[model samples]
Target chain A: MTAAGNHQASRSGRRLERAGIRDVAAAAGVSITTVSDALNGKGRLPDATRRHVREVANRLGYRPSAAARTLRTGRSGLIGLTVTTYGEEPFTFTEFAYFAEMARAATSAALARGYALVILPASSRHDVWSNVALDGTVVIDPSDHDPVVADLVRQGIPVVSDGRPAGNLPVHAWVDNDHEQAVLGILDHLADSGARRIGLLTGTSTDTYTRLSTTAYLNWCERVGQEPVYEAYPAHDPCAGAVAADRLLARPDRPDAVYGLFDPNGTDLLAAARRYGLRVPEDLLLVCCSERAAYATTEPPISTLSLKPGRIGTAVVQLLIDAIEGVGAGRPVAQVMPTDLIVRASSQRRSTRTTVSPPRSPEND
Target chain B: MTAAGNHQASRSGRRLERAGIRDVAAAAGVSITTVSDALNGKGRLPDATRRHVREVANRLGYRPSAAARTLRTGRSGLIGLTVTTYGEEPFTFTEFAYFAEMARAATSAALARGYALVILPASSRHDVWSNVALDGTVVIDPSDHDPVVADLVRQGIPVVSDGRPAGNLPVHAWVDNDHEQAVLGILDHLADSGARRIGLLTGTSTDTYTRLSTTAYLNWCERVGQEPVYEAYPAHDPCAGAVAADRLLARPDRPDAVYGLFDPNGTDLLAAARRYGLRVPEDLLLVCCSERAAYATTEPPISTLSLKPGRIGTAVVQLLIDAIEGVGAGRPVAQVMPTDLIVRASSQRRSTRTTVSPPRSPEND
Candidate 1:
């Protein structure tokens, strides 16, 4: 053997000499097999003996090897939540809220099914498959050409995404809010409310939901035989929305209504309009595609397409648990929960009262 | 042996057979000694052989027994992050952002020093100490009688907290934001802005930071011989701020300025004030604690006390890493990063040419 091999063997011998099963057994005054049985909670040792053995083991700082136990049980009982690096900000408030909700839901689900949920932020440098200790992973922010999903698939790790990526991974499953239909519904509501010309304030172009919402807006404008005006801004910073709104509203033929792709953007647009002395739904109508907290308390509470974040969180957790429990990989499931158009003063053009839109049907989407 | 004892012995034997050194050796095409060396990454084996062994072992789902590994190595490369369940919603957003930032920093720090961070949600049902295989934990939202810290201490698990908990644990190291100074700074700015009567809008009374800020506001008001008109709302929900503002502003002797504990409350108050036709600063001045995303885009741009979240995140990670690396013990250490009050139109009196208050030493607090 090489000198390195000799050194390693000597180190192992020293480690064993420092603290071994024999040491634990000697300290407990029990046989090695008896100590093992007590440590594993396997045999029905006398209560006093079991207690004594445990106390001694604790005092001695003995810890069983996780690898050995996992191999023997065929289960790690560990669930991982993998979030990607979107920008300098590791995760947004919306993403954080979603993750917390999902983590709580998954934790409860894991407990019921006998497991633990570990929130793991997948690094840009490491492949998702490297997190092999996880029984399964709940992937968030799936891009069109996600390398993480590809690696996970290669290593046969079950993955469920918070949003649907454009990849054709057969064994993949995802849960998402229907942005296409939601945007269309918002546009329809604006048209029904007598908005002659409507402007769209969009989020970052790279996001799937933003792209999808933009497509739906263009399609709806075409169907209604109306010209669509829009301004795109990065979603990460709300300040970008204000800048976009300023540019869009400065035109000679400014829109009578503004539809924001998300809650923050919608709120920012409204704030911008207020700065410019334009009144909501009178001088300019406002609508947003998300139901985040800010939309509810704005001066003239901005109209929102309410996506049920908690419900989506719950569904994702259930799907992940199902997959981990050997439920046939979930059939490339794409479950889209519908969005509710909550009309508040910002988009309420009509003098008469109107009914709030019903909750979206999850099954239909 | 008794029949039950015999049965348990047979089951344990089968478990041992499934996860023995022989199994790993066979999977890796190496002798038991070579397999052990590769698993430990200490012996001189061909790099390809070591890589193949690790891959095959992972594929075969090898999990080294924690008991065995701990006894041999005297260490477990696990660090924990403990968060309370009370402020799950708002705290989730704040904590998740902080956690993600901390985790990223911690991951690099821990990996360099040889460790892993494991997130643990505070729970009464399951003992975090028993459930987690961690060398240490970073505690958050510490309560007077935090069970997680208590249990971990009883079990002798090293711990650090983001905030001070009620009980003084012997080995607990903690880091906290200087809320007292932050609140005083914002209030002082409001006072300098020609505001005679200042109102305070605080987060939920339950939060330690909210309580700290409220006390500071009351104390500062008492010292200045001014009546502090204040209202406390639940958590960080902007809707709560809107509701509270309705009552506070509707009063006959309404305060000239409102100082919010944080951005959401401040932004909400601004929105509500707009609904009441009270122009900011000219009519009712405003200032807030944290400069979150919403503050920059609000109408008349809300002035905010900017707490460096990224710096705080970096500090928390460094502290936790220090403890994990055995550089410190269970002692309370509070590190307060400086705060900057960014003056804007919301808090600026139109008559005054000086928008910014003169910079003051943060050490004054």
Candidate 2:
């Protein structure tokens, strides 16, 4: 062990009290500002002086107070991840594979950029959003008039959202899939499978994802001279999804093929089909938007439109960090990531086609 | 709107800067300390004074600096949730349904109590752990003698782990399931269903969950006068589980029934059974520990030992918050939450028995 190692070991043995910044300044023979600048990588200081300050600080086991440093620099190094709740749950964080995967990626990306994420609920009643000294925020599925995003932006904190903000809600930067294009491509795929009509299982909320996808489905039906067969539910309610799936299947005007908009729709549709003794891809074709790999092993693996939440998460964080760090200027920085359609047994009609297309990779612009 | 709300709405409309505590004090005609004490519920302020100060603060849209508040109170209202990583991924956060459910519950519970969770990797470089101000930490499956725990405890931060610490690493509190009881119960359930031999699929890691479960299986075999049969693999690798499951079934002395210790082992073992052309519950019986509901819809739904991660998560956060707020000091606070076993088709011999027992609930003593 070198001097620093020996110093750390000796400090560990005492267990009396924590080392302070003053001890480091005295030991390194520099002022406290120089010590702060050296440790925080702020201000201009000679390389040798900075290294000496850091070495002395480490050897003395001086942990600069994160709270004090945050107060001084006015940057808490904390990012708030705000999720819109659909019910009594504080956050619909685990409602689907998409949110969980997206959150995981966002956490990883934020940490890599030297910031930690704080999970904040947009529906909390007790000033939850204002309590945290967040450098910025990532709002998932912001409503048309989300007061949290409005307040944060009003306070001059950069707000980046995962979904395109509904209505006129303002965000510093937004990231979303080309929902219209993804829906259109899926409709085309279903059409190629010789379907006369394509029904939709969608959410009742007016979030941009549900709105855009629903509009795309309607436009496609009009263009192809087919009637729309769909059911909308309050997506935040998990049980409501099953009811909606069954309702759609029970409709007398049910289409031959259907696309569900949420993650659990694949399983819900399959179970509903089983209940009615409907054979998938033969009597009724099936597809859903999902991020789960479990679809790969279902009874007859269901084809899924992958929103590529992993890419969206990574991109959202990169943009948020860039805006925080004053990078990526001269551009509005809105990103529309591509979606992947993993072809499986459920979506393809066996009588008409023997060849299946491979997983469609998103065309990044 | 009332005058206070109207004042807030008007300030928000102007879109200027946020009001500080001093602004609140000036507006409310009170001292800064009086405003702080009243808003923070500190000091012996009367109810009317508290209400007045809060009203003034809300009217001015005064948001206190969380950093300054943290320094003043020695609490950041932030808890650290540390996940042990398998490899390059920040966390095996998506590795299993258990982590996802547990994290969701923890986040909800934390938010309900006016604190937010920070997701931190257990293996981050650059002083990642100490860089954020944390009131406490929740460590998931911490290794014995973890330096992170040591350093954190040395600094007097309360840490509550989801799993029992492996070695001598000290945590302020811990919550876990009784692994031995859960394993023995599963083994007996299989034996009662006409199993001549039993096998085990477990992880190669030394995590207390894996170690304790495997030891219980060995001990049960010893007591029951049956030869031990088992296969161990690095549970973090998704592909390794398939190979391990196959090797266990392909053994010359393969057991009639198998109990897997990890989440994905049920699916992996089922696939391996298919390769061997063995039908479930007739040629073989299977059980695994998992929190996924998808197991219910598999081809022959698989039985699972639910660790009751929701309860554990809620308990972990309760203990952590209690410690953070200096509550529950005199009581013996180490918790052993109950586990629920959801019995499905895969673990039963349908031909031999027409009856099935309900879920086994743990006795909390």
Candidate 3:
């Protein structure tokens, strides 16, 4: 066996002559054994010598083959972010904005703690759970009994979610806004304003956030003993909300107040109100759940339940980093941050509007 | 030296006991010589034996160790993206959106050709060009006489830039929108509208896009024989644009039309117009360059010059993939696509008379 190993080393050495241990040793002014010892962390070499050898190897543009490294470490810094098909929903600008914000936040946080975030588009061609060389994964919008989540857990990769779904495998950690309480708060605010009939506009039922918001709205209506009038759009774009608003408002029994589950949905509802000649508040009230920058500048500034997505993003990063460091593990953990309701012109009734004060000229304001 | 090397190897083996030639031989059910011969493509071996040996080693997760593998491969599939900082500019959102789109496109293209994109944020802590493990990098918004670009070239790592600075370099490939022509087109449209004095709302001077737009605005102003009244904002946010518009419009000789370099700038300008009691188009015409979704939903929809950012992203990916596949070398390539102007209400001034259509009764369009 020893003689056979010597023959194997000779053949391997010849094949790797251009980029072999000898070249690295020569570059670092160290023996081949020293270089080998430094890389594998063995053989009682001085710390400085090991550091010097490693630095020189890196400087010389050396990379251990991934296949070989995987065999040893059983891990890779890469973390896959599995997003549902852009084709399923056409990747709207709003989704793009949220993802961008989340990606930047996640990347910075990951790097600070020594990890890399690699986005992997969820495609049927590759197994979401098995193909990529990743240490862990963060999944967004898991469905009821999502196969992706199941397969990933079965493969033993740590999984964190943006929101929880009806899944058997215990979720490692999750960060989400308290949508139910947020909806109840909005409803209570509207009820206080003497809105007898309130209408609800929401995104597709597929998203967990939308479903949660809908459930909360229905519960609030039941508690208040009021008939629930609502519309769920097939998509999340502003156009969908606008069209839904038109249909809802065209009815003889129009809603006195409208609540949108998201920013685009809220913005669209406002546009539709203008088209229908319904003066905000006095004629029809409007409120949305997201405090996106665009909402703050729209015509009659929208009243929104500030979800503070940036804050949520920061929290998600902190949690992921903690998990990566092996600080938190075992059993599921879910975090819910408080939401703030921002009251603006859209929900302020004209009669209750203390002063018309020439719509605070955009320039002056 | 050979005896010393053997002694050190033996000592290292005793210290670590990590998988190496001996382990691969054991797993492969072959002599160590056969395993090495198969891996190196040196000594002749039967195809079936080589396949079986490789499969068994893979199953056993036997890594030759970094030192052993680094001695055989000189390249790493890591690519770097050098950005100054993630969130320093409001452009982060815009930049991130573009980058994500570009990344997705590049990933698909790179995989087809075999490469991976690794992002490395540019920081002041150290010269990133000197430290990252990368085959090549994509530099964004190069400053005039950037040393980083020079360092990358000296190191022989290929670079592709989104916007190359004025100073010359042996750039591998570049991709940029034709801002000069795009701005010129917007100016031509404004000139046709019979506007003599036009005000420009430009974004921060740090961006290459802003610099290009400013130069185009000045040149167009000179050619049309109109005063180039302009204000430069500190950032690209809508609030900055609004503040700039206020300063420009508040002057006794307020310009008739405001041309913003992008959508947020235009949105702010329109908002300022409302605040200043100046009706859009009638009192102050407005036009912007980006076709961001905000334009379609504004109270008075702002006209926009829509550039296909997604297409540009796709094009960049295609070019990078081609270069990686050895399609071209030592050849600097650049490509630009056309921009389309979508006219809307903000710039429409057929008549100034405020038509008081009956308050859109809840039933009207």
Candidate 4:
């Protein structure tokens, strides 16, 4: 309680705090800038010098002040990854494997580059969004009139989106799969499998992926002189997918082959086939867009149009980081990643070729 | 440039800046405290007056400064959600359906409390963790000697763990399932279904879930006067689960019934059974702990012991928020949530009873 005690208490408070960068520099007998460069792996520093500085810092247990660094660099070393939801469910994170896989890859990519990701909702209030300083953002499937994307653009935050932005929403960069080409490839694959009448399972959503795939399918159906036999549903609802698949199969003029747009449509359609006494590949050839490994284990593995979410996620983060670190910040980078069409029994015609299953065979000894 | 042009440029620059809390106060014709209260849904205020102030603030596009608010309240309104990794790979976010569901519930619960969750890694370096100011942390399966959790606790930040801490890790609160009770109940279920010898496919990890479940399994086997039959492997690797499942079935003393302790164990066990020319219910009754709904549609529909991740997530967040808000902050809060056993064709005796599916069936005319 005395003046001397107060002085001692203040001194103890200082001791309780972790060592700072200045202490590291003093301990290393180097300039503060040299310590910063050595720790951050930046500037031209000899390997020996960097090692020596790091050892000194380690010995002192000195941690550089992130807040001080942010103040100096005007960067928070934080990336915002936005997930848009159709309803009030908290973690549609697993509504589909695509979003979960894409996010996992993006988080991995961001962490590798000394940055951390903050998961924010697309419908986040402006106050919540603006609270933390973000160096950039990755918007997953931003719609044409996304007010969040627009707001980020206005605030001078660089954005890289997973899907192609609709209506020319000026994001700094964007990465998406060639959906049209993928759909057309599926159509050709089906046609080659001796499909006279091929149907489509798509979504009622106006997102670019659905739009492009549907347009491509309609165009293919017209060129092939086949009537468009397709069913559309709200893609966010898994139950809706099952219902739609059933309706498509129950139609009076059910097509012999079907291609679904969403991830769950494969299992839904397969189950629907079972209910109607239709055999997959023989009675109802099937293909769907998905990134799940579970497809490889389905009764007769269902073929898939893989968006290669990992590649897209990695690319989006790379572009966003480049923008943040001032690399190609203004180059208007737009990347188009490729899709993979994994062949399985569900989509192959009855006698095209002998199918080899995944490396596991259940043949008893 | 003319003086008039210079003045105009400076004025425009000021205009381009976002409206601050002060602007809201001025626009709403209220004091700054009243404006803060109105926006944050705090304090005693008439509903009509609050609505009027909120409308005025919205019209002015006013945004509060997160940094300033943190400094004033000594709380950042941010929660840190740490995901422990098994290997060098970045995303264990989707490693299990449990994590995805838990995180979803946590995110929703945090958002409901006007707080946001920040996903950070358990192995994050000091520089990265120290940079962000956090109100509290939710650690998912932290080891006893985790430096991150220790650092947070030493710094006087509250930490609520999802899994029970291995040792006295000094967490402010924790929420976990009664793993022992759940495992024993699972054993009883299989026994009631006429399981003479119940083998286990478990992980070699020292995590509390594995430790408790395996211990309970051994104890139950002893109680029933049966020899322990089990196989252990690293649970993080998806391929490892399949191999372990095969190894268990390949054992000379292969039991007629089995329980798996991981998410993908059901399918892996089923595949292993097929490889050995074994029928599911007739030859090898099966059960696994998982949160995946896909199990419902698998061949013979696998039974699952759901840990109720949503309840755990929500409870963890509520405890963390209560700690952050200084409500029962000093209270020793530890909660145990119940588990759900979803009976399916895989676990029931062949002629036990008619099984009920989930509450959805496509209404067909």
Assess the local accuracy of residue A348 in candidate 2 as a C-alpha lDDT between 0 and 100: 81
TM-score for each candidate, following the candidate numbering: 0.75, 0.89, 0.78, 0.85
For candidate 3, write residues A1-365 as lDDT tens digits. Answer: 45435545656646442244556677787787898899879999999999999998878655444444444565455565655555532234566656656666666655655565655555433322233455677766666676766656655567777666555545578888898988888887777666899988876666668888899989988988988888878764546767887877776778899998766777677667767787776678888876355666666677777666555656676776566657776656789887677777777665453321223322110
* TM-score for candidate 4: 0.85
Between candidates 2 and 4, which one is better according to TM-score? 2
Candidate 4 docking class: acceptable
Off-target runs (Cα >4 Å) in candidate 2 are A1-16, A41-48, A125-127, A250-254, A328-333, A350-356, A359-365, B1-16, B44-51, B328-333, B351-365
Ranking of candidates on lDDT, top first: 2, 4, 1, 3
Residue A136, model 3: Cα distance from true site in angstroms: 1.4
DockQ values of all predictions: 0.14, 0.38, 0.15, 0.35
Give residue A126's error in model 4 in angstroms. 4.1
Q: Which lDDT tens digits does candidate 1 get at residues A1-365?
A: 65535544555655343244566677777777888888778887887888888888778766554544554554565666666655533455645434544555555555555556555555534422242356677777666767666766655667888877666644467888888888888887777677889999886657778888899999999998989899888877756767888888887889999898755667667656766778776778888766354455555567777666667766777787788777854567778987667777677665535534632322121
* Deviation from native of the Cα of residue B283 in model 1, angstroms: 4.0
What stretches of model 4 exceed 4 Å from their correct place? A1-73, A91-94, A329-331, A350-365, B1-60, B71-73, B92-94, B354-365
Using TM-score as the yardstick, the better of models 1 and 4 is 4
Predicted candidate 2 versus true structure: per-residue lDDT over B5-107, tens digit per residue: 5555666657466787766876887777899999878999999989999999888878888888887777888899888776645556335477777877888
Number of the predicted model whose DockQ against the real structure is largest: 2
Name the top lDDT candidate.
2
Report candidate 2's fraction of native contacts.
Answer: 0.51
- Against the native chain B, each candidate's TM-score is 0.72, 0.87, 0.73, 0.86
Model 1, B95-163: lDDT tens per residue?
343454455555455544455555566763453235445677777667777766776675556677776
Per-residue error at A298 for model 2, in Å?
Answer: 0.7
